[model samples]
Target: MKKYLLLLLIGSSFLTACAQDQFQRTSKGTMYKNFTNNTGDRIKVGDIVTINAIQKTDKDSILYSSYKGAPIKVQVQAEGDMMDVLPLLTLKDSAMIKVPTDSLFKDPHAQRPAFFPKGSSLIILLHVEKIQSLQEAMAEREADAAKKQADEVTLVDKYVADHKLTVITTASGLKYKVVQAGIKPKPIAGDSVYVNYVGHTLEGKIFDTSYEQVAKSAGLQQIGREYEPLKFVLGQQGIIPGWQEGILLLNEGSKATLIIPSKLAYGDKAAGPDIPPYSTLVFDIELVKVVRSKAAAPAAATKKPAAKRTTKKKTTTKKTTVATKKQQ
Candidate 1:
């Protein structure tokens, strides 16, 4: 029985060697046709290559290809097998590599299949584009950061100039702003502010609002319905910092113009499609009402109600404290 098992193993090994020989090139004075990856140059282990190749069957039908920008950078790990065609690429040399799907990913605790497709197989055709060095990658990232800062500054300047936005501090205190006398009112920290705001881009494109939010929550999607007042707790991070800070300046019925810097708006990331990357915002905000919550004042005091009568004369002092420090 052991002799029979040894013979079976030897036969299987011979068949595996024969199957591998199909992928090799033979040279009898170049008479045999050699299947070279005629697309790009050979790839190496450490080179980061971009591929726009597709998988297909033995009859050559394509499955997928990169349709967007330049090719992607494939980072090679320090250990394990790094695909089959790593030995066939050079720097800036583009080539196609066919990788088996079973060899792509491996997980032990998975359900259903063992390998990628059980008895089936798949292929990944790759093209070696360019190799990225650590220094080169860092430098490129730093350059992008610098460009973003310059853009944000430029956008802020343009917004301020075009909108004629003013930033005058007010005697009413409480994050003050002056817009058409008595039109804007000061709000306390704990007030629930209902604001009708239209946020616009540099080209006067409104991207978001409270009306849109209510309509969206109600399953309505029309643009006209998206223009409504949104109610939120003041000083909370529910909206951007610009919105929070700007709204705190308005009295219960104030209409104010707020020109926000990109840092205060979306920070580093781009907002909605209308708000481009590194964009400054202009908001025309109208304060609807200051929601007076019964529990808003007692959040920090924690004193007895009968003792509160002794501090009745200090109501304005308590309101001032709520305006400044806040409970947080």
Candidate 2:
């Protein structure tokens, strides 16, 4: 009786291993295995599907994981791609997909990723989280954006009140407070202005500055960088809207604080590792000089080429906090 039971246990273990190795091939020749076959509604074309996914090589080395951050939301496509397999998965379903490296690098001219070598397969482990219709997805996105914008406004307002700042609110929602008044000549559109500025997040973490001491204090000092006032033409498309509008209210030698909302800055996109998406920025700005455009400049200055903007050296600094798109 003991021998018969031992043989039966061995047989069951063998069958289980064989079943685990079996994978189904799709019409497009992709190999897949479903671990949990749920009866819930399966994904469909145009459906926004949220899933937690882990991408790895055949060797089981993980390349990327949505679990570390946020689950991925993808709009299902008709056919012709790995995403086509999404239609087979229902909510809460878990599956494994194997894609041949050769198929991924089909173009002979294309270079294959070093991790996924020739003859290897890229594996994807997926867990379906949620599924929504196209209309539902759009509505949810809008609702989320509105909530985020409202929350940002609340934070900004609180920051202003906590700091006991008396600010002038602009029509576009920017807030500024003059610390010290300067001369009578304020800058206008098309004027080349040189300004020294220090920028930080709402939490008071400095991200960028034109002053060497400020950068050193914030631990953001870049080697071989020449810390100097940033120069840019007012009303230019390259600079952030907040700086363009706020700087117009200040004159040479004037010092002020500008509290910029994300919409006036980077908006939904993160500036760099330091500045997250939807961040509210604060800047201490000092207008050093202003040179009017030729149209606005005195006649004698018009003969000279509009003072060409030049850089002292090639700085390795990443332009995360500068007003200009490429760092003013």
Candidate 3:
């Protein structure tokens, strides 16, 4: 009985080693070893898969690790060489794929990374976390964008409350409080206004200013052009929606502070290297002057009426007629 049991244990160990050594290769020269069974639901095309992956060169130098941050979300397709392995994965599946570097940089227009040398292998360790339909993924993205906007709004509301600011909130989400109510002649929608302003983030970092002294002080001056008030047409889209709406609320020479939301400013997209996405902006604007657009003159003021056609009554020619008859 002891001899029979020993032989059976040896056979089981051999089978286990064979199972662990099993690996598959795709036609494109991708070698993948699946550590998990594929008995669960499989990933399909058009499905959005969320994965945490760590990529490395053949030398084992780490290129990227999504485990350090958010998992990468991708739509499965059989086209891209890198994405070919995605269709073979299921939720909670883990695998390691060795892809030829040349295959990825095959396109002449593609730029290869400098760190990855030619003829080396690209190692990928992927873990598929979740799977969802394309429609579901799109819906989730929209919900996330909306939630971010809501959070921004809440933040602005908190700032307003904390400061005990008395501001006028417009229908379009612009908040303003007039500082110096300048002379009459409030700007209207069609006016061209020149404003000296300083724009900053909520943290009070000045990004832009129209005044020379302020620009010099902030070290943001532009060479060759003298600093002066920025002139723009009111209600025009030439500037941001917030500036257009807020400038019209003040009169000539008026000074006010505008608290603008991201929707009215850059809106989820970063403006530049300085401004991040979904940032609320603040501006201390002084309305230098509000001049009406040249074309804004009243139509009737330049119109000319048609000249009246006058008719003179025929004069009596009796004296002349009699003189001609007498001479005849």
Candidate 4:
């Protein structure tokens, strides 16, 4: 029985080796096929290469493609065993790699796309286009970022001038234009206020809002989360600093536009995947209602008793009139 078990194990190992020999494989079990053998300069560590990559699933559902725009520049580094193929590619070389989804993402807790099913596979077709030094890539990216920042500043200034807005600039560099006046009682610290707001980028792309229609139009509606005004305490750290400062200036029922610069907004850190770093934001806000302090709230609650008493008196008169008619 021991001899037969040893023979069975040897036969299985032989068949596995034969199957692996059919494709170029990484030590971690990822398989690849080289489509072209261009004798161009091979990739090396510390080299930044521009490559056109298309990622798809076994069902041919394309997840990402670089054909629409410029190829992505990637630095060849040892991120994982599957990434070891990056140094084996030459300029103008093309290859397709098949990777097990579970093996690629070994961490069970890692977040994945909703479309990517477990125990499935991914196919990546990559073509190396060009190569550059690490220093060159960094310098180019920095230059592009600086140019983008300058252009954004110019655009914001032009919009302010074209609209002819009479905006009030705060000491902290926040610009606000009040469209409509509100009641005399303005909100103060520790007061709870309900606000309706639409937040957008400088380019007029709406990111978020408290309006159902706006969210629906933007294709950002969440299931079962009905849209309504947001309520928070004023002058607390419950919200962003720009919101705290801007909302305090408006009274109840006021409508205003707050133009917040990067420093007063998210600054150099990104708020989410959609909001880039150093982005300027705009908010159209309406102060809905303000809840008074605890001491004043009791007084407001006391007035409700008088209102209830008046309603009771009216009901009693109607009942008496009906009884008198019945007797007649």
Sort by TM-score, best first. 2, 3, 4, 1
Give the per-residue lDDT of model 4 (tens digit) for 33-120. 6667888677888899898777777566667777655578878887654367767778887777777787756887888766677877
Better of 1 and 3 by lDDT: 3
Clash pairs, candidate 2, are none
lDDT of all the models against the reference?
0.54, 0.83, 0.79, 0.76
**Which segments of model 1 are wrong by more than 4 Å?**
1-66, 69-90, 97-125, 128-130, 163-185, 211-227, 293-328
Candidate 2, residues 90-191, lDDT tens digits: the string is 998877777888888989999888887889887777788899999999999889888888999999999998999999999988999999999859989888
lDDT of 3 by residue, 42-140 (tens): 889889999877777756566787755678998888776447777777888777777778877898788888866688777777778899999999999
- Residue-level error in angstroms, candidate 2, position 247: 0.4
Instruction: Provide the TM-score for each candidate, comma-separated.
Output: 0.56, 0.82, 0.69, 0.61
TM accuracy, model 2: 0.82
Off by over 4 Å in 4: 1-22, 25-30, 36-41, 46-50, 57-75, 79-81, 100-122, 129-135, 183-191, 201-207, 212-223, 234-238, 266-279, 292-328
How many collisions per candidate? 13, 0, 0, 0
- The candidate that wins on lDDT is 2
Instruction: State which candidate, 1 or 2, has the greater lDDT.
Output: 2
